[model samples]
Target: MKEYFNNIYLALSTIFIGMSVTFKHLFVPAVTIQYPSVKPQLPTRERNRLYVNMDDCIGCLQCARACPVNCIEIETVKKIPDEDLGLTSNGKK
Candidate 1:
């Protein structure tokens, strides 16, 4: 008999607790945002791309080492100080 009453008390107390939580949430303001109608603001600084100028690259593996994806491959010929190569597209010798 005592165990039966304990079980009934436990069930009622759980139901009361659950209903209190539900009532608390029912009175709270809704935090949901209407999507598609309102767009979120993006960050000002974008790091979505990596731009490199081949003219300025000296075949150093620093970029490859710094790259997170390890996708950068540099291939260049070492030119002699006296050797004269044609001007680049930017007109730099």
Candidate 2:
């Protein structure tokens, strides 16, 4: 029937389209980098910073919660109710 031919045509067209993409990529050179040996240079304008000073941290988990990779871990100890830990350098109690 016409429907059977249409299904066959659709399957062949999709297969050709998918194989075309695979063939195009097969001829292209690989862009994989040897990360341990060759480090990629960053832009001059980029700070490329990845450090956080614990002393300056306000115990806010915003950085940890917002991290895309979930790499930042914050462990806070419960302070005694009557203990006075004093204010931070930024005057945060």
TM-score for all predictions?
A: 0.37, 0.38
Clashing pairs in 1: none
Model 2 ranges with Cα > 4 A deviation: 36-93
Global CA lDDT computed for model 1: 0.80
Residue range 50-88, candidate 1, lDDT tens digits: 667776666787788778898988777899999976666
Q: Which lDDT tens digits does candidate 2 get at residues 1-93?
A: 999999999999999999999999998987988987998888888754356767677678877876768898998788799998887667787
Candidate 1 deviant stretches above 4 angstroms: 37-93
Candidate that scores best on TM-score: 2
Candidates in order have lDDT scores of: 0.80, 0.83
The stretch of ten residues in a row with the least summed lDDT in candidate 1 is 46-55
Tally clashes: model 2. 0
Candidate 2 clash pair list = none
